[model samples]
Structure formats: C-alpha cells, structure tokens
Target: MNTRPAGQDYIATLDLLRLAAALAVVLFHYFFRGAAAEGFLAECYPLAAPFALYGYLGVNLFFLISGFVIAWSAESRSWDQFAIARFVRLYPGFLFCMTITFAIVVLAGSPLLSASFSQYAANLSMFAPAFGQPFMDGVYWSIVLELVFYGWVTLALFTGLFQKRKLELIFVWLTISALNEFFLGSGAARLLFITEFGPFFAAGVLVHHIHAHGRSLPALLLLAAAFLISCGTLSVTRHWMQNHYGIAVSSANLVVANVVMHAALIGAVLLRHRVRPSALILALGGLTYPLYLLHQNIGYLAINAATPVVGKWFAAVGCVALMLFVSWAIWRSCERPAQRLLRIWLGRAVDIGLARFRRVSTEAQPAE
Candidate 1:
C-alpha cells in the first residue's frame, strides 16, 4: 500500500524509540562508565558492565534520529524559522536542565562534583568549553555537536542549497567525513565537519529521504556508504573507551550494534503507522532531552548519596525513576511553556528584522 507518512506527520514510534535511546545512555553512564576507570560510582555492577558498555552507542542512535527529524523539520521552513525552531526546541530544556544540574552540584557539596557561578554563566551560552569553563555535565559535548550540525543546516537553508542540493551536500559531507577519518586525521576537520559522527547523521537523512520521497538508487547507495562508514567510525569510540575506561569494544560487536540500531530506525519508520499517537507517547519523547541533560553528574551524585541508605542496586533504580519523573515535570512545566513564549518572541523579532531589511533593499533599488 506504500503508506509512508508525510513530513508533517508525527511518528509515535520514533518518540518511543527516542525514549529507549535516552534510557540506554542513562544505563551506560550508570552501569558501565561510572564504575569504570572514572570511578564516578562507589559501587560497581560487573554483571551489567558488558551489556551497558554497548549502551554508549545510544548517542550514535540519537544522531541518526536527529538527522531524520531535522531533515523532516526543514522540509517547508525558512532559514529563520528553522533557526527559531531549533533554538526553541533546544535552549529552553538546556537552560532549565543546566540550571537544575548546577543547583544540585552546589547543594550536594560533593567532593566529586562542583560548579561555580562563572561556569554556570558560561554554560548558559551552551559553549562553555570555548570560554575555558567546563560543562556542568560531561554529556554536553554531544549537545555541542548537535548545535554545530544545526548551524550547518541553517547555513544550507540560507543559501537555498538545502532544498535544491541536499543529496549533493550529503555526498560532500560524507566524503569529507571519510577523508578526515581515514586519511587526513585532522582534529580540526573532525570537529568542524563532525567527521567521526557524520555518517550516522547522513544515514539518518537518507532514511528520511527514502521514506518521504522514494527509494531512489542514489539515496540507497549513499545510505549503504553511510552505514559502512558509520561502522568504521566506531573505532574512534573504541579508542576513547580504551583510553578512559580500560576496555575496548570488539570490532565485530560494534558492527553488530550499529546494524541493529540502523535497522531499528528503519523498522520504526516502517511500523510507525501501527503505533497509535497519544499524549503519553509525546510526553515520553519530550522528557528525553531534559533527561539526557540531567542524568549524568546529578545522577552520579544521587546514586552516590542514596547508595549508603538503600544499597547500590536500589539506589541506581531509584535514581533512574527520580530522573524520569523530574524530566517529565520539567518538560511539562518548563520546556513546553518556555518554547511557546520563545517561539513567539523570536518569530516576531525575526519578522521585524526581515521587514526592515526588505524596506531598505527596496529603497536601494535603481529607478528609471
């Protein structure tokens, strides 16, 4: 029947999938990485470590989903509109979560975690690393990558290339990603082009293109290439884990995990129609952002504090539940209302700036 949904249609399955990815990341931090060389946790879960070691791949899954969602979001939006949407979508939750994390770190007075006012102020810009201040939570490095991706998208939209030459752009991006990753190995290129993670994002965009438009041969081929490159790029993560955690994921295991994630994404889109959309599904999706932002450092502290009273496993479970609930509350009370207000204000400001620019251009036109 070829019942693929349009760009405007909400995919309830994706919402559920996003929540699952976020939970995977939470588990990774709590069960594996925390107890690894970092020693963020006092108690260790040796039984769960092997499985949770792979959970870090959830961030890769997130970039893939983001590529799809961002491509879909940009379909009919102007550059300014897209910018506003991205800002509204990200900044509110980020601001709320960052503030909450900062408050908790200060209150906890934990020797392991601390935040200063300058750090908080710099984090407000969401690029605290540039200002010689650390991110309050370590997970924010991924958020910065996301912002860079958004910046590139916004630039593409402004140039009209996003609509007219999206595939070409993806091709160029993938080539650069491969070159930098395999041959050049330039740190600057890696950061600027997101070479390490670009394939996941590119694969995601191709998935959306195939679903929305059709299975054109170029799209399919590019997708295959993206998948292959994405597998190769996991070595970067492997090396990172080795350096930090003293363990490395086997290449075969990485490939298998990558395949499963990509397949799951494809299946979610294909089966989205079978999953009914509801407020619950939407709310589950909404909490992922705040949960990701809030889970790492604060959660370490929560588990640390509660473990003494409730024991390790109980503290871990309780922390996850508390994080989920707080994330939901923030989504409902803070992100939703703030997004509405920010969208309206940012939209109006953009309109005013655009109108004034148009008037100035018109006045500058040559007359007969």
Candidate 2:
C-alpha cells in the first residue's frame, strides 16, 4: 500500500536486512564452518555453535536482497547512471578490502591461506578466474556472483530488453538455471549464466515487478515458479555446506531458512514506505558492504594472532569488535568518499559522451 515509484529512493528496510545478513555471515564463518579452527577463532567457540550453525543462510538472503535492490536500482535510470552507481558502490570498498587482506595474508605466515602476487593481481580484476586465480578471500565468491548479476542487468538495460520483455527473460533464465542446476549440472553454465544462483535473483526481480506493477496474474505465476525453483535448488548450497563443514544440514532447516528469508524480503518490500527512513538505516546499510568485504580473511588472520595474546574468548570477541570498527572506518573513510568522487567524475564523463554522440548523430543527419 505504501509503495512508491520504482527507484525513487532507497528502501530503508533492506538496509536493516543487509546488516542482518552481514552479521549472519560473520557468525557462520566464526562458528558453523568446520574451518573455524583452521584459521581464526583458534577453536570453534562451542558456546555459540548451536546458535550460529545456520548463519550461512545469510548469503542466500543477501542474494535475494541483491536481486530486488538491483532491479529497483535500474528501474528509472539510464544504463550509464546504473553502471556508474554500481561501480562506485562496489569497487572502492573492494579495492581497499582486497589490498588490506593481501597485505595481512602476506605478512602473516599462514601458508594455507597465503597469497601470491599473481593471485593478488587476479583478484584486482574481481573476476579472478579471468586471470587464473581464486578469490582473494573465500567470501569474495558471493561478490563475484553479484558482479556477474550486475553484468547481465547491464546487458538487459543496454538492449532495452527489460520491462516490456521481463517475463520472457525470467522464463528463459529460469529454464537455463533449472537445466544447469538440476538436470545438466554444468559448472560452466552455473558461472557464465549464474544458473545456480539465478532463481534467488529472479525471485527478487519478481518481487519488484509484483510490487511496482500491482501483481498481475502472469507476474504472480512467474513469482511462484521462481520461488519454488529457488526452494528446490537450495540443496546446492546444502551440498556445499556439507562438503565443506562435514556437517549435515537437515532439509527442513534449509526449507525453514529459505521460507524465513522469503518472508523477510517480501515484508521489507511491503513495508518500504510504511517504515520511516532514517539516517541510522542509511548508515547501517552503508556499512554492510564494507563490513562484508573486509570481515572474513583479514578478520580470520587478526583473530588467529590475537587469540594467542588474549586467549580464545577474549580474542574472538575483541577481533569481532575490531573488524566491525575497521569496517566502519573503511565505509566512512574509503567507500563513501570514493563513491562521491567517482560519481561526480562519471557524471561528467557520461555528459561528454552523450554530447559527442549527439553531435555525431547531428552530423550524420545529412540535411534531412
């Protein structure tokens, strides 16, 4: 009932959800994962393991939010505005976090997680596979997925294939995703087309379409299909968890997590204008990106060092606080400033390019 025009302003509730997602991921890395003892935290903090066991669900939540937010972001802008906004939003924080992680890993003697120059250089591209290296931090995989999602969005915008043709796009994407994820299980498809993770993003897009366009029958059907596909394909994430953590995640828990995530995301959309936007909401949202980018590898190494000096409980706690602080500092110092400057410069560039294109078009009119 409180829905505003698409892309008019930020949906503040999603900011709160972003904070929750980031915190969930932190908890997941700290406790639920088998690798907790492998790097930082020294040993699994058994005290929190019970509570944190399902925190990995946060990534799925983040993906859902990303779909919704990105769709909303592109709704009322030219391709250039969307591109610049995304670049400024993502890159500076990424560069800072990656560089810091690289330095810390190099300085620390953690060979298992240590970096090579090639790896660091590859990571600078963000799409590290192009340069023949893995992500600088394990957490970066999600961000890579986000970038891939952005690329497709850009293509859709460039071709002007969205809106009038959105349902068709979603159907084709869902079909490809289903084949790759469920039937063919092609890793190449998963990476190139984001087939494995397409449903979640699709779900988010459907939510946006429903919200903005008043939930037409066809859109509702597509939304239902997308949700079911996402729910059905969740086992991919479950299998990965099992393989990595050696922990059996019950199917029921997975269902519940997905269900809750769905409800939460939809509720946020429904409450978009119902909830008052505030500086605090904006601030919290602003910090989530930097927090996520900076938290994992560097935090692990920091925890590994501090755990010895301060003992396990104090070390983990202290390091969590420190990482949060560092994240805030990065947001305030690096990310926000970079976004401002980059947006200004990109605005000028876009204007000049548009001017050039207009002049060329005028020159080519041929006295008509």
Candidate 3:
C-alpha cells in the first residue's frame, strides 16, 4: 500500500489483504493440519483439508507486506522515532496475546508442550528462546524473523544507508540471501540472518521502491531476481511439508503463491488510485495482528473442547468467529490502550534522556 502524504496514514485495501493472509494461516492450522495439534478434529473435514495445505503461504504474504510497510514507516522518521513506533505497534498486541495464551494454556491443564516459569519470563521479551524460555506458541518463530528484519532496517536507518543507497542495499541483500541459501546452506546462517527467507522481504522492499518511484528497467530486473531467488529457496517449506505431513508440497503451488503475492502487492499499488480509504478497513487491519498472534494454540484448545459439544463443522467455524470477536476485543481493550500508554511513557523518557545528554554535552564543551 502506498503511504499517503502526511495526515493520511491508513490504507484500506492493504488492510483487507492483511485479513486475508491471516485467515489463510488460521485455516491452514485449524482445518488442514490443525487436527494434528487440536486432537478433536481427527482425520476429518476432508473436503476442505486438501485445499488448505498451501495456506502456509500466507506467512510469505505477510513478509512481503511487512517489507513494504516497514520501509514506508522508516522513510522519514529518525531511528529513535522509528524504533518507538515499531515497538508500540508490535509489542502491545504481542504482550496481550502472549499473556492470554499462557493463561489459557495453563488453566486448561494442557500446558507445556514444555511450559515453565522461566520460559514464560523469556516470552516477555518476545525473543523467548534467547533467554531460555520457549515461545508461548510455535507461531512466534515468524515474529522473531520479523524482529530480525526490523533490526537490519533499523541499522540501515541509523547509518543513513537506507535513504540514499536503498536499491543498492536491496541488491546486496538479495545477493547475500541467494549465496547463503543456495551456496553456504549453513544452519547457523538460516537461524540468525534467516537468509533463506530474506528474498521475500527483499522482494517486498523492491516492490515498495517500484510503488513509490515508477518502475525502472533496473528495478524490474532486481524484482525479478528477488522473486526467482525466493522460489529457489523454498526448499525449507517443501522439506517441512514432506517431513512433517509425509506429503510433497507442489512446486506449482510455490510458484503460484509467489505470483499471487506479486500480483496482490502490485495490484494494491495500481489500485491505490481507485481505492478510497475507509476506517472500517483500517480497523479490520488492526484486528489482524492480534488475530494472528492469538489464533493458533488457543484455537486448537477451543476446538478440542468444543468439537464434541458443538459438532465439528460448527465448532471449527464457531471458534473462528469466537477468536475474531476476541481479537476485536483485544484490539479495543488491550492493544490500543497499551500502545497509547507505552508511547506516552517512552516519549517522556526519550525526552528526558536526550535533555540530559544535551546538558552533559554543554557542560563538557568547556569555553566553546
């Protein structure tokens, strides 16, 4: 979505894309392979199951969206402001979801696929395992990837590299990702830099450059390279599908997902002219982060309990509805308030700290 001129922040159509990608993920986990986790769905819902297999592509969709938007967010702001904005945007929803999930899982007595107090403490930082605490849900792995992406973006912003050398940086990033994924193929590389998945993020960044500036032959070439590299590095997902589910993930589906994402993103930019912004759409987008964060483990537990009482189809659909409602409530009650408060507090703190630094600098200047 194109960032409108100042005073026009929200883009309605992109919000719809957010909801769609999140719903695809939920369906994949709940209806398709969801049975594996929830235990009540069984070898059931066969009609819908086959089609849902590819829903994991939603995560890639999400990465693309983040790349576009995060770049937009960073384009004009100081790194301090950018960091604060990202924190308030991400952390509030994350905190609410993590705490809520921990409570639900614990109270339900199905806790700990390996849960413990130390892990719970670690989860507060959102990097979980770094401090030796497990993530409240497995879905958190992507969140960490997002944080790493942000780290790089933040570094770029700090060095003034992002503004002047944006395309060059993307080219370098894509090259590094390709070399890491295809050539080095090191486990540590995948873990820390997550180079295997960097192309998707780079593709989104390249798309943003195209969206903001018009398409150039050079930019188009880079976009093409990023997309192809992403396709090549999909070995991780394919291997995951085969190992975990004992089924091959079709290469055609991988190609289709990539194509669809390119179209969706490009289409958003194209339609930016036609699509008027709406608050409803903005709110819908707001619900997505919370919904994505809260959906997986808790939904599984809900499904397990509700299935016998409600019947499978109704239970699944009903739980989806229930979570939507829950997400809305979280948005209204938890996320908005927390973000507002954190911003106020952080703003004052940054001000105080900066003031102190200025004072100390004046003192140290000595007869200047």
Report the lDDT tens digits of candidate 1 across residue range 255-298: 99999999999999999999999989888998999999999999
Where model 2 places Cα greater than 4 Å from the true spot, the runs are 1-7, 34-41, 109-112, 361-368
TM-scores vs. true structure, each candidate:
0.97, 0.92, 0.94
Which one is best on TM-score? 1
Error of 3 at 55 (Å): 0.9
Compose the digit string of candidate 2's lDDT tens values, residues 1-368.
01122438768888888889989988777665634435444566778877787887788889888888788888887677778778877888889889988888888837556788999989988988777898888888888888888888888988898746888999999989888888898888898889877898999888988887886988888878888888778888778767866665688877887889989999998888887888777677777877787777777676667777878677667766887788888888888888789889989998999999999999999785
lDDT of candidate 3 at residue 49, scale 0 to 100: 79
Q: Candidate 2, which ten residues in sequence have the lowest lDDT sum? A: 1-10
lDDT score of residue 117 within candidate 2: 94
Name the 10 consecutive residues with the lowest summed lDDT in model 3. 1-10
lDDT of each model, Cα atoms only?
0.90, 0.80, 0.81
The segments of candidate 3 whose C-alpha lies over 4 angstroms from its true place after superposition are 1-9, 37-43, 111-114, 365-368
How displaced is residue 323 in candidate 3, in Å? 0.8
The per-prediction tally of clashing pairs is 0, 0, 2
